[model samples]
Target: MSSPAPFSRYEFMIAWRYLRARRAEGGVSVMTWISLIGIALGVMALIATLAVRAGFRAEFVDTILGANAHTTVYMAPQRVENEFTDDVYVVPGRIQDYDAMAAKLAELPGVERTTPIVRGQVMATANDSSNVAEIFGVSLDALKAMPRIVDPQTSQGSVEDFDKGVAIGAGIQRELNLNIGDKIKLIAPEGAKTPVGTTPRVKSYEVVYVFSAGRYDIDRTRIYMPLAEAQDYFNRENVADEIEVFVTDPEKVDDWTLPLLEAAGDGAQVWNWRDASGSFLSALDMEDDVMFVILSVLVLIASMNITSGLIMLVKNKGGDIGILRTMGLTEGAVLRVFFLCGAFTGIIGTIAGVILGVLLALNVDGIMAALNALTNGGAWQPEVRGIYRLPAELRAWDIFRAIGLSLALSFIVTIFPARRAARMNPVEALRYE
Candidate 1:
């Protein structure tokens, strides 16, 4: 007679029958249920954690690149030597021909836009409230082109009125109780030279626009004014403290450093966004890797329940195994049958986990909002976490990785118990029975 093919219809039927066996019949149905649930929960947790990590990283990088420059070119410090004496004096650096320099830098490959800016720190007060603010002086065109500030979706007021007044962050507006057309007084410590000393420069400007960068710190402290106005306020007339450079890809900003330097010519230095935030990004990456490993271990532990369930099933079915062996079933067929039982549980559990995890990730924002409401607010602190909301972004790779890891672990753990059942001796098993 011809030998039966591997995993034939009879083999599947027997596996199904064994899987459906009752507790009164010495089956491990209870253990099977526990193992399946454990694996499902484990996979779900892993996928959710990965989704949050990815979302946070993406949001952070987007806020940085959207609201700030990818790279900045600053005037290098200059040393002036006295021709009559062996003395040298270091003076504050300033870019005199910023317009020409900005035009030159804009022509470099990968350069998208360049803007000359004057930056200063001042105390701003309005409606009897005060807060320290960082001011950026940029041209009307550059201010209008800014990503987060100019985005109509997140920002309010008009960019056309930017030249008439200053654009303030939402946090600043809230703290100072400011609104469009409100006058905010700016107090600068450094002012015009006088016989006594440099006096504080005090000026008040109307707030024409309000914006939210989706970051608490930025929204709380940043202010934008017309470039000419900023230059005068900061005591930088016809010159810029730095030229902000926007590139096509901020991630690849380092690659353009050399060309940017050459185009900027002498008396200039370059600082990229990575230079300011590289350590933070590195910490994020390291945390992602560590979290993945820790969650994978949890998955592996969950799969251990599968091993225990299959072992119990093998022990309970020994008598039936003896009869099947004596009836001419091959060891490989027995192994395949038992393996199918464990594999089925894993496949089902993984599918359930993927479904539940994807759903949670997609609705994380709504869930967070509900949670915050239940707790009477303060559930999520944007001031501490940097973003206004909890974010979860489901990536295909993260989902696939969770599924693959769970299933692989399930199949591996099932091997030992299946092997034991396949290797059982028919004579010893029948005698015991």
Candidate 2:
């Protein structure tokens, strides 16, 4: 085989020689430096944006999953054919044969745990003292699984008392002025069969156990009681308001839901946290998308600097390119000279930006602390009154995307300038100088 044309050396060396010439002349102009700086900054911002979105999404989702059920199943009547329903009226809290339904669902694939949760609106009181507290009635097994409720320090005592009666939230405890031995009256509206006939009923249970879920609403106003206690208090039997299912893979809800629905047959429905908290999830998605677009625009603007620098370099090296063209270098080789320079600028900028971005993200807590001290006159402290930290999760995919976008932008800017340099007439180019 014949050796490759000498044009290959010229193509590669042209960009290198031009860069060295610029560096030797006390480096490029401030504008060229500024372009490189802009590119670097743009990439940094993009990386940061991705980290913030990923971090926040992961944290919030974890919290939601920690408290809320991964997959919830609501029983439907025989006449009800829909698999899922948002209409609370369609699937009432008093679902018949709930115990039997839970057992059947447990047999389905991917079913790790099933917890029967009783949800009812009730006004609670502590010996004439009253406060609005959310009561989540769970069986002893489910209560053990619920870390938030079972873990908080309780002066009032253990959840075993809950099986005897109801437990109030810590917030309610502070608000309603309750103690371990104190009796809190639980009033729930229900339907009961009286001597005369079936009628609406109201009943009260003493507060025996206190639980805190470590969440604002829960710690302050949530109570966990025994499932049986809730049923008796609500005058409900052989009925469960909702069944919470814990699945192996959280992302595999759709895959599990289809089969679960088939097994559940006509009346059963599935509700995921994504469905329950669509607004929050939507906002999270919007934040990520909006930031991505905005940051991409910034990168685009920054990318232009690299473009301008390359274009200028082409202009400066016109005479040299003309000589090479006269020496049998293909126009294609000349075009690649500038194109490689542009690509290198993007690659270098992206690499530097990533390093700096990671450093900033890692030190955000310290940075925030410094800013708070400087601005707030040392009036602020982190990790109390709130989480007091900015979170960032550096995802590999995000890095890949950043590199792709930045380089793609860099390569795109090379097109017109590279083409112009390659298409120049050697005679015309040399005649000008």
List ranges where model 2 is wrong by over 4 Å.
Answer: 1-13, 20-27, 76-93, 123-131, 147-221, 258-269, 279-283, 326-328, 363-390, 428-433
For model 1, residues 1-433, the per-residue Cα lDDT tens digits are: 9999998999989988888868585448888888888888889989999999999999998899889999999978889999999699997789989899999999988899999999999999988889999999998889877788888998878989999999999999999998889899999987788999999999999999999988899999999999999989878889899999999988899998888888888877899999999999999999999999998898888888888888888888899999999999999999998998899888888888888888888888899999989987779888889998889989999999899999999999889999999999999888878
- Give one digit per residue, the lDDT tens place, for model 2 in 1-433: 5535644765667676666554544334444566667778888888987887787677666656666788888765433354575333333534577777778888887888888778777677765577766667788878767655566553357667667766676678877888776777656555577898766545555667666443445556567777886776666676788888888887666677887777666777888877776797789898888898999999899888876777777777789889988987778878888787777677778888888777777776577678777887353433242223456789988888888998899889877888988998999889988
- Provide the clash count, candidate 1: 0
| Model 1 clashing residue pairs (backbone) | none
Candidates' C-alpha lDDT: 0.90, 0.72
Task: Give model 1's TM-score versus the native structure.
Answer: 0.96
Best by lDDT: 1
Which sections of candidate 1 miss by over 4 Å? 25-27, 79-90
